[model samples]
Target: MKTEDEWQHCLTPEQYDILRKKGTEAPFTGKLLHNKEKGKYICAACGMELFSSEAKFDSGTGWPSFFDANKENIATKRDLNHGMIRTEVLCKHCSSHLGHVFEDGPNPTGLRYCINSASLDFRK
Candidate 1:
């Protein structure tokens, strides 16, 4: 496994900033926002599998939003930053901040797992 320092060296400054520091990438700038493939999205920090391609959908939100995460693969916490209350999602094992959850989502769950591409590693 790559150590934390190795990960820092492997990713670019912008990737490290957003993946490790919970920073946001500019809207409409994520490559995965329009990806349509059979794969899994893992945590860039620790390689923990987070979401499946089957759960992905287009929300016109300019980010990768999933209807659900892999079972027990993610952890969530209440975020009170940015002057608003939101649920912050993290990789369960790595605790790397992925993104936030909102109630406005499509279908069965009604949950939008809006995530930053910088925080995820796609595996086909």
Candidate 2:
């Protein structure tokens, strides 16, 4: 595990704010929102594989949406912030905030993992 100082030093300001501080990137502004490449999305802080390109879909919600994730590398918990109750996703390996997951998604899993691009790095 890396110290907070180490994370700050290694990550960009946007990555630190979104991954470490649980901050959300502006909707429709994430770099991966329109990405259709075949690859895996890994945690920016820990390099843990989180999502596969096969699971990605355009949810029209402005964030990178996935129908499935690398379950072993991710975790979720109740989030009651901003006057709403939601499930917040995290990178289990490093405990970095990734984003949230919702039930309103396509068939097969019916899960929409609305993630922040700053919290992830793509590996093709």
Best by TM-score: 2
How would you encode candidate 1's per-residue C-alpha lDDT over 1-99 as one tens digit per residue? 556697689878877888678889887899888889999999887788999999899999889999888859888999999999999998888677899
- Candidate 1 stretches greater than 4 Å from native: 1-7
Predictions in order: lDDT? 0.87, 0.94
**Worst 10-residue lDDT window, candidate 2:** 28-37
Top lDDT: which candidate number?
2
Segments in model 2 whose C-alpha atoms lie over 4 Å from true places: none
Question: Lowest summed-lDDT stretch of 10 residues in model 1?
Answer: 1-10
**Model 2 TM-score (2 dp):** 0.98
Q: Model 2 over residues 69-108: C-alpha lDDT tens digits?
A: 9999999999999999999999999999999999998999
Model 1, position 74: C-alpha lDDT score:
89
